[model samples]
Target chain A: MIRTAFFVSGRTAITAEILGHSLITQFDDVNFRRIVLPFIDTEEKALQAVAQIKAQAEADQCRPVVFSTFISENLRKLFVMDEALTLDFFETFIGPLEKELERQSSHTAGKVHAISNFEEYKHRIDAVNFATTHDDGGMAKNLQDADVILVGVSRSGKTPTCLYLALQYGIKAANYPFTPEDFADHRLPKPLHPFRNKLIGITIEPQRLSQIRQSRKPDSQYAQLSTCEQEVKLAESLMQHERIPFLNTTRLSIEELSTTIMLKAGLKRRCY
Target chain B: MIRTAFFVSGRTAITAEILGHSLITQFDDVNFRRIVLPFIDTEEKALQAVAQIKAQAEADQCRPVVFSTFISENLRKLFVMDEALTLDFFETFIGPLEKELERQSSHTAGKVHAISNFEEYKHRIDAVNFATTHDDGGMAKNLQDADVILVGVSRSGKTPTCLYLALQYGIKAANYPFTPEDFADHRLPKPLHPFRNKLIGITIEPQRLSQIRQSRKPDSQYAQLSTCEQEVKLAESLMQHERIPFLNTTRLSIEELSTTIMLKAGLKRRCY
Candidate 1:
């Protein structure tokens, strides 16, 4: 049975969605139509959300599930409807936290994604700029400053992973593609020699790489299965020869790749 | 008092960090030294995390806070420590969800950010590439295909916002900077005329714009406050004349800005 799951929050609803997704993803057998109701900070907005939830429930002929992170007690109470199953994150944790910490909960909202610290916020933006400048071996001179430089064949999930690292963790991630020239050379690129410690190789299955490249450039020589196999084999061998750690991105998402790279490089996140 | 807060998970621990940040941000008075422990799928890893938490608690002279999203019942038990306040996300929500949904949760891990749907995953990657290629008026001919086009003064947060929209929501976000030439014309850029509905103006406080420009090109005319003010005024006027909705990005993070823009543009997310 398909049910509607509403993720309600006082602010961006990002946290509510994250928490809700974690719970809902467990029930993979059931399909859920996810709806996000952000900035529902008032009783009126809460009432509106309630009505929407009821309407969806009526349409689906079942109770809609609501996962909320509303800190306002009044706003939270408004969502406690008989028409839906309400799971309030703050209500479940805040009171316990208050007692444990020996302090009353402030019960404020919208601080999760706010620019609470300017220095850190700017640091993240700078990281993103750095990644952009250094993408696809651009600005190789700046490789010395990169927290981690990803080496891989083109379309082996380098660009997105670098961007993810920069955007998510404030880590200056530079990625260099393993070109045909580099493959023929049979050695690490000269520029990458000095910063061996900061190098992480990304590898993908030849079949998968061919499929991805085919999507980008259909019927091209680069997208041929044979070409993909040779390039991936060469890239993996070079990484292994250099003793550089690598990850296969065939099954992993960008988030997983970035997180794994951060851990492997022992790189500290500049911002949370 | 300062305390160490460990965000532990069986997978990337990203959700744990998000949920923990949501809860901990409520207590502005307390300082938290946050640490993320991802990929703790094994009992040994959980035990190590428990030890780390204990060490942090002893060092801080108080119990550390542990926010975990481990789906494994065995791994979950290992985190239950006398030296830390353990808050398990799955433990708190799964049983209640089962009761509410009238279905059993699969009790799986690492599916939250997985590429479950290949088509959606490719769509997200394509969006990112589109945002990259069409960034800063690179491909004016491709603007017609864009889901939303962001027009703003340079350094008013056009690049990061576009990138965030692409990476997070899989929205084809192309940005065009209102340059001196456009300001001289006292009108919207000619390229943006065809797709007015796809336009969203990004504006920042003159002071903030100046600061951002100064960081990029210190001591340049573009970094001057007066130049920033003039550019911003002209951009705002053009946007108002063209009836384009705008957002002030001075206080918003990329996530907040992108979310708000998606809402304003009525752009449905292509990925969850």
Candidate 2:
């Protein structure tokens, strides 16, 4: 049995669990151990955890691949020095983010300005709040309360993106349907109109959208090859005309789509 | 104006934004610059970000404290080495979690399993799902679908917790109101009797309950301190006699209470 352990350290326990579960889902036929140690606030704890994993690996006679999020340098160094552990995926993944944060830090210095236009931002917040309350299927409301809102047609990875946003960010994110109704109207739904600035549209390659929809609805007009092409064209045109920023959810995980959308929308980020 | 930039690197951008917003709420007078750098998946990118922040700090003449989550170590080290930045709070918080994960890796070598027992944990998921559905003031339904049904008086944090569990862990947590009608009848609601083994009770301190109730209905009997106290006492005694596990949500955050109840009920964790 290949032994794997996910060490998630963050302010939010729920976020760690979601990420751990998703990572576990990527592997097949592997024995996985998930232990959540919350409130990891220091370097000493990181080292102690490393020592424990090293001992466990020797006892089990198996090399361990440790997947960790939010570990400190002092402890990470101890793991790196050990010859037994094979991989440190967290270090590999976070490498880019840290660098970017540093570069951006200088550019943003003295640039952080509060919304003196609190009234404007407040209006935006209220619009979103209204959109959330008015949405049907209880789904719209769920996403409207989201720190970020994703607008897209069916199967553009809205549900998954919403779930990822909620699960990973603990943000109440809502996705609204860009249905035929919205398409024919040639405008965002009336409820979404006021929050237009916060409105982000998600588009996808027509072929990809069709493929995804095919899995769910197969024979419907919504999933038909031609219909998908037309819808994509129409949605893109609408977003362009209205000047709403949109993203292609095709070939992206819910994580990727949400990150791109949030970036484009300039939504406040909760997680680092 | 003290400018603060939030560097978010995570799977969910909206979550990052919501967290950013929440953090912003913590300060009374600070300039907040919201920068959304998405799809940051490499160390070099993190370095670039660090450089950017450093420049911004020099320009602003104030060292910036970065709020980040899920950032990598190589990047974190780069930031730490850079004297331009003052704090990386997420990095500090994740330190301990890394160590704990390393320690557990040995004992549970390859034993960590991502149990697809969502079906088994369906009740908990249902309850949460129900709460989310009901939280936006939707109707309670599919009581038959609940796992361990929760019955309590209103304002018990039932809806919030249920939604949290569902949205966070995908637990199917269903909650029913122990209305005066149900109490007068001296029986569990009709649908809940069949799932008695799955029934859990929730109660709150009378004063807290009164306070919460007052928010929705000021000057109502239900919001009276005495009335709340009576209901809580009755609910507690009844649950004890019925052998149902119960929790008091008065002091617990929705997260802590949910974890405690799930553990006490032996409910399989839905997320991790």
Q: In candidate 2, how many Å is residue A51 off?
A: 16
lDDT by residue (B135-181, candidate 2, tens digit) is 42245456555544667887676755565566455667777777666
i-RMS for every candidate: 1.1, 11.3
Model 1, range B1-272, lDDT digits (tens) per residue? 78788999989999999988888888878988999999998888888888888888888999888999988999999999888899998899999899988889998898887776878788889998998899889999989889999999998888888888888889999999999899887888788889999999999999989998899999999899999999999989988988999999988888788878878888888875
List the lowest-lDDT window of 10 residues for candidate 2 chain A. A104-113
Complex DockQ per candidate? 0.79, 0.12
Which lDDT values do the candidates have, in the order given? 0.89, 0.56
Give the lowest summed-lDDT range of ten residues in model 1 chain A: A105-114
- What docking tier does model 2 reach? incorrect
Q: Is the docking of candidate 1 incorrect, acceptable, medium or high quality?
A: medium
TM-score, structure 2 vs. true: 0.61
- Per-residue CA lDDT of candidate 2, range A59-156, in tens? 66765545444434444555553524433333443444345333322211111112223233223333323333433324443343545566777666
Stretches off by above 4 angstroms in model 2 are A4-31, A35-132, A137-150, A154-176, A204-233, A250-262, A269-272, B1-38, B41-48, B59-81, B85-148, B217-222, B269-272
Which residue pairs show collisions in model 1? Answer: none
